[model samples]
Target: MTTIDHAVVLGGSIAGLLSAAALAPRAHRITVVDRDPLPLEGPDAQVARRGVPQGDQIHHLLMRGQERIEELLPGIGDELLALGCEKYDDVADFSQFVDGAWRMRIQSDLKVTMFRRPLFEWAIRRRVLALSNVTVVKGMAVGLLASSDGARVSGAKVRGAPGGTLAADLVVDATGRGSRSPFWIEDLGYERPVERHVRIYMGYSTWTVRLPEGALPKGLAGISASASPANPFGVAIRPCGNGLHDVAAYGMAGHYPPDDLDAMAGFFEELDSPVIADVMKKAVPASEIVPYRMPGNQRRMWEDLPRRPENLVVVGDAVTSFNPIYGQGMTMAALGAGVLGDALAEAGTLDGLAETVQARLGPLAQVAWDLAVGADSVYPQAEYENVEPPSARDRDRARAQSAAQSAEGAVRVAMRATALYMDPAYLGSPVVQETIDRWLTSGHKPAPEVTDPTDPPDVTPGVVRAADLLEPATAAGRLAG
Candidate 1:
C-alpha cells in the first residue's frame, strides 16, 4: 500500500474539516488551510465568521448527514446536544405550509438537529483539530503546486504569513462555491471542468432572536412556508439554542426579502400564514439582520473531465452548490466526505483515487441537483443552462405529490426523501405514484390549520448547558466515548 505522508485540505468549513477527519486514519499528517483565523476559544468560537457570508443563516443537520458525521467523528451528536443544540423529530416537530395548506405531521424515526451554521462548524472544527494527525493553518490558498513533470499536484501555495508550498501526497479542494480549483487546473494546462447553472435569483435575510416563552406552539420545533411563483415569499423559524432562534425569510424569482428589521417583518406578513409574523412580534433581536443572495444553483462537472491531475480531488460546494433554502449544503459536504472515505478504503492508495472520487460525486450531486433545480424550474422566470427543465406533466406530478402530504403515508414517504434517508427514485416508484394519484383523485382534504399552542411545552428535552463543550478535555472525552 502506498503511504500518504501528508494530505492537505483547503477551506476549514464543514467540508474541509470533515475531509481532514476522513484523511486522519490514512495520512500520517494532515493540514487544513483556510483564510479565516478559525476561532478555537472564547465567545467568538461559536459566533459567525467573516469568511462564511451565510454564517448567520438558519442551518439544518439532516438525518442522513447527522448519521454520516457521527460515523466520521463518533459521539458528535452527544457533543452537539451537550452544547445546547436542539434535536427533534424531522416530521413531527416541523410545521410545513405548502400548496396553500398545512402538511400533515407524522411521527417517524428520522431526527434532525438544528443550530446556527457557525456553532455546527465550531463543533466539527474542535473535534477535527483534536485528532493527533491533523492540524489547521490559517492562510489563503492561491494556487496548486504541480509536480516537476506537471503530471500531478504536489501541494498548495498559500499567499500570506507562513505561506509557501506545503507538500502533500494528496490535496483536496473544499473551498466552497467560490473555489479556485477550476482556474488552478487551467493554470496547469488542463481543461477546466464544464459548468451548469440554474439561475433562480434567490435572496435571503436572517436574524437571530430570543423568543418569549409560549411564542411558538408546543412540540413544534420549526415553522416553514415554501415559496412559489405565485407567492414568492418564504420563511423558516428554527431554534438554535438557549431560547435563541434563527428567523430567515427568503424570496425566489427576483422577490428578495429586505434586510431592514421592519421591512423584514412586512416581508413575513406576506406569507401564506400569519403564524411566523405573530411569533416575530414577540421576538427580541439578538443580532443584526443579515442578508445573502444566491444568483443560481451551480455544478462543475469535474467527473466529465477526460483527464485530471493525480492526487487532487474536490469536495463540497467546490463540486456542487445547491440552493441553501433546501438545507442540503452541509449535508452534501458530509456525504461527499463519506464518498471520499469509501474511495480511499477501496483503492488502498492514492492512485486513480481522484478520478474515482470525482466520478462518484457526480451521481451523488445529481440527486440533490435534480431535487433543487427541479423545484426552482417551476418558476418560469428561472433561467437554466446545459439542462432542460422538467416537462409540465412531471412538474404537475411533483406538485400532486407535495399536495398529497395530507395523507400520513404520503407525508412519511415525502419526509424520508426530504431527510435524505431514502433514494429520490423511491418517490417515483409505482407504489408512491399510485398513492399520490389516488390521494389526488379522491380529493383528499388539507390538513387542519395549525396554530400556536396556548401552553407551550418544554422544548429542551435532550439539551445540556455545559461551560465549554469545545474544551479539549471535554471534546476528547466525547470522542473517546
Candidate 2:
C-alpha cells in the first residue's frame, strides 16, 4: 500500500469538499475542518456562518465545472436535480447579447447546473462525507504548526475544545476568501502574500421564485448590457430549480440594486439587460429581495511568495476570487482541487505542495483574472485593483473599438469564442478557426447566431433525463430511485 495516512482540510465549502474527493481514493483518512456544523444530506435551510455572506446568490455551475463534479462525485449532480436544482444546456437556454448582436448558436451540448449556492455546496459536502475515510468536525482554525526548520508546516492549531491541535501529513486550506492563513503565517515570522484586487464596487439584490412546477411559457435566457457608451446594462434570467426561476439585477458598482422596494422596482425597470425586467414586470415573484455585495476581485500571490509552509496548501477563494458577474469562482476552485490532487499523486513529499499547486494553477488563474479585470476596467472606480498592468489585452474592447463595434453582435461573438475555447483544444478546431476568421470579417459571414429572447423551460422537458450528457448524473438518481 502507498501508506499515506491523514490529510486535513480547512473550510467545508465547495473547494474543500472537492479537494477531499480528490484525496479520498489515495489518503487513508481525511479530516475536514469548518466553523459551521455541516449540513445534513437532503434539503435544509440556509444559515449564515462566519463571514461567508455571498452564500445566497444564484450560483451557476459552468459546463466545465459540471464535468468536473460528475467525474469526482459520480451521481451527486442527479441528486441535486432530484432535490430541485436546475440543469440545462447552455447554448439552447441562455440568452446572450454582446457586440451588438444576439447569438442563436446551437447548444454545444453543455449542461450547466443552476442552484442555490448553499444547496450546491451541501451536495458536494455530502459526497465528501460518503467516503469512509473522511470525517467532518466543527471548529475554527487559528494557525499552522511549523517545523523547527521553518520551511515546513506540520499541522494546525484549531479552536477545538480550548485550543486543540490536529496533525497531518498534508494540510489543505479551502477556507475561503477571508482566510487568515497568511496573517497567521506572518505571526509565525513569515512574509505576507501579495494581492491584486480589481476595484469594483458592486451590490446585488437577488430574488428567486417558484415557476409553476411543471411547465412554463418560454425557455431560459440571459441578457447583458455593456458599460461602453452604446450599451450600459445587462440582465440574465436562467432556467433553475426543480422547475423554478431565479432573477437577479446587477448594476456597475454604485448603480446596483438598492434595499428600498420602490427603488428596487425602478432599478429593475431600468436594468441594462431587458429580459429580467420583463419577467419581474410579470409573475408573482417569490423569495425576498436578498442583497449582497463583493467589493473587490482579490488574489493572493502565493506563487511568488518567498517562502511557504511545506505541508500546507490553500485552494479555492483563498487563492483567488473574481467578480460574480462572470460566475467563475466555483469552477476555478474545482479546477484548483483537481490540480491539488495531481500534485499530491506525483509529489513524493507534501512539502512545498502549496507553491506547486500555485505554479500549476497559474494558467487558469490568468484566464479568469484577465476576463474580470478587463470588464472591471470599463467601469468607474475599477482602476484601483491594479493587479494587472494597464497594458493587458481587452481583445474585445480593443477589437470592438477598432474592428467590430456593434454592442449586441460583438459581445455575443466574444462570449461564444470564449466559451468554445474553454474546451482549450477547440482553439485548434477548424470550425473555431473559421469562426475566428469570420468574426474578424474574413468572409464577412453574418454573425453566426442571433438568439431570440427566451422564456423559462418546461418542468417535464425530459431533456435532463438520463439519456442526456447529464446522464452520468441523471442516471445515478434513477438508480437510487
For lDDT, the strongest prediction is: 1
TM-score of every candidate relative to the true structure: 0.89, 0.81
Error of 1 at 350 (Å): 1.1
lDDT of 1 by residue, 438-467 (tens): 665666565444332222222222322122
Over 4 Å off in model 2, which ranges? 1-3, 41-51, 161-163, 212-218, 221-233, 272-275, 385-481
TM-score of structure candidate 1: 0.89
Full-model lDDT for every candidate: 0.78, 0.63
Candidate 1: Cα lDDT at 71: 90
After TM-score superposition, the amount by which residue 234's alpha carbon in candidate 1 deviates from its true location, in angstroms, is 1.4
Lowest-sum lDDT 10-residue window in model 1: 461-470
lDDT of 2 by residue, 1-481 (tens): 1335988899888889899998888799999888877867434534434446777666666666676767788887788888787666665565445444443434344557777777677667766787899998788888888778667777788887244988878788899888888897887678988878876777666667654432333444433433342434445455556555666666565656675455666665654445555556564666677777778688888788887667778888998887786787888778888888788778776656678888877667666666566666665456564355444334333333222222223323344334322333323334433333445554323333332333322222222221322222332232210
Off by over 4 Å in 1: 161-163, 397-404, 421-481
